[model samples]
Target: MSSDRRDFVLTAGKLLVLTAPAAAYLEAVETGKAEEPAYKMAEHYWGMIVDVDKCIGCGNCVRACKTENDVPVEPYFFRTWVERYHVAEGAEHPDVDSPDGGYSGFPEKYAAGDGAKSFFVPKLCNQCAHSPCTQVCPVGATFESPDGAVLVDKSYCLGCRYCVQACPYGCRFIDPRTKTVDKCNLCYHRITKGLTTACCESCPTGARQLVDLKDPKDPVHDFLRDHKIQVLKPQLATGAKVYYNGLDGSVR
Candidate 1:
């Protein structure tokens, strides 16, 4: 007998001895269908690549993140955001502003030949391997997943705001409704199902890319090998996974 026929016969024979649910199993076996394999966290080491020169300050990433994650619409709450930086020709620090967490596109503030070079920098959770937020969570509510995403357990959170204060990148925020600290998880729900992040999907300029460092075939390896990359707040030694290309020195 063919494999399908053999499977069907074996399943049918067992049906007489098994429970009603076996009927469903038999049908699946006969059709050569099986459940999707569970996602293996160990198989992936997730990260992100942001190309600064390609970011256009359009706020698409911010909008997509809020829409996908149901983050509070208030200006104070954001899973991801963008900042506009103005580096004056002789200024000591770059003038940085992110109005309403860049939910809306930025307005033109500098005129032509203002002697200030302006650019957009998109920001999100660094998914650090050695995240301070995880260390400061006294209740063990916040943690780094095996796949390199930083996640929070709302049920275990004490709402003490320790993690929020510990985050050097200003990425963590208290979800007012949940009364717990929340931050980006790199869209864990979508990524586990083989989908890219909402921010990456929405970026028109292809500035953002989701990467799997463990996958030898993933393009992130080639990109990293070829480009000069930097991460936010490297001095803190957070082991941040978000890599930036063409990062300016003036950026904080």
Candidate 2:
């Protein structure tokens, strides 16, 4: 392991000892010590449910993600990205934002009355079960956590663009300032601290849900079992954890 990783491990060990309750410290220590040397391969598979029925394309989630993450104002480094799908009565390949992230308003572009037919679909890192980004990382810089969240070790990343190319969803990108591969970590830092991801918390329509599939009691899991959901690009066989309950077929 690199010196930085060693330091991180040491720091984490100390932090656990200091923060763990007195009654749980010993158990925590044992678990931490006995744990695999590498990052835990997540036991559960996580997925998301996007309720297109509830989404009004308000862009609240997008704005919230930007403000929370301190992401550059440039039209890049998007932790959550939105796409407007303009499906005419019954047509495919409807006009889109031309990859520049520009789109007309709902009522004006799709007609106020017909807005129901044309809707926007926001996309983000799917956090796949069999993630292509994980498979392509030569240094194991990108990995899945025990909670089934995909993340990148920016410190270890070589910036080869392998993960960027491997992602079928086109979610990964290289950070121009850091010169490293960067993408949505699902706000792992915030979630681990008992907080919802910025996108999920900011979503005014409650369309996006960050769920723990391991816990059957989780509302998201129940919703998935209860509703008709769609997985993006399942053909690539990444075992995508993100599921869209009301995704229009044209979104693939």
Candidate 3:
């Protein structure tokens, strides 16, 4: 095998070994041999590649996510949201807005002769390998899955807000209705059932594409191996799973 392929297999093997105990425990529970609760084994590593160049800021994704997740109407608990970054050439200040929590049906405004262009960036939990939210959760409410997805056990959350503060991206938030900390799980429910996430499915421009990195034949895995990709806040060493292709320099 090629060196790259060998390295990938080695890494995958290590991850499998690390998750063996959890898998066994979950199997026992599923068979009624244990009383403890555990997440079901994920056979694939979920990944998303967003092409910022194709994003149109249509807000369809935001609306779909809210409706699918049954998010509260007031103080919206957005599983995904968009950020508008306006940068002017040689200007000291730039305007930022997420009108109507990013569900506003309107075009973005741009200044005339602006030195730099403005763009809308969609934001969500990165589901990092070294997730700050999971590490700081005193009650083990937040956790990282073997497939690199970050999740929360809402029942175990103590509402301490430690995870919220620990997240540098400001993705986690306390749900007003549940009073528990919440963030994106990458639509775990839909994914496990072999369905696309509501947000991804609703995207009109097809800017969001979900793939399983575990399968070498998958387009996303091939793309990541062959092309350049950028991760959000990579300097923080979070090992984020979500990657952006054709990302703007101002997207950080």
Best-performing candidate as measured by TM-score? 1
What TM-score does model 3 achieve against the real structure? 0.79
How do all models score by TM-score? 0.86, 0.77, 0.79
**Candidate 2 lDDT for residue 178:** 84
- For candidate 1, the per-residue lDDT at 75 reads 92
Worst 10 residues of 1 by lDDT: 29-38
Which runs of model 2 end up more than 4 angstroms from their true locations? 1-45, 98-107, 113-116
Deviation from truth (RMSD, Å), model 2: 10.9
How do the residues 1-252 of candidate 2 rate in per-residue lDDT, one tens digit apiece?
699999999999988887757647677677786453443335444557778777767767667776786665577667677777777666756765423332222344556676446667877889887898899999999998767788999899999999999988998888888888888888876766657788789788888988877766788757877998888887888888888888878787
lDDT of 2: 0.76
TM-score for model 2? 0.77
What's the lDDT for all of these models? 0.93, 0.76, 0.80
> Rank by lDDT, descending?
1, 3, 2
Report the lDDT tens digits of candidate 3 across residue range 1-252: 699999999999999897989898888878987853343565578878887778888888888878888766553567788877787766566567777658874464775575777777787788788887799888888999887679999998889999989998888889887889888888888887778888899998988877777767778867787768899988999978888887766666
* Per-residue lDDT of candidate 1, residues 1-252 (tens digit): 599999999998887678667887898788867665678889999999999999999999999999999999999999999999999888899999999888999988889788889999999999999999999888789999999999999899999998888899999999999898889999999999999999999999999999999999999999999999999988999999999999999888
Model 2 residue 168 lDDT score: 89
What residue pairs are clashing in model 2?
none
**Clash totals for all models, in order?**
0, 0, 1
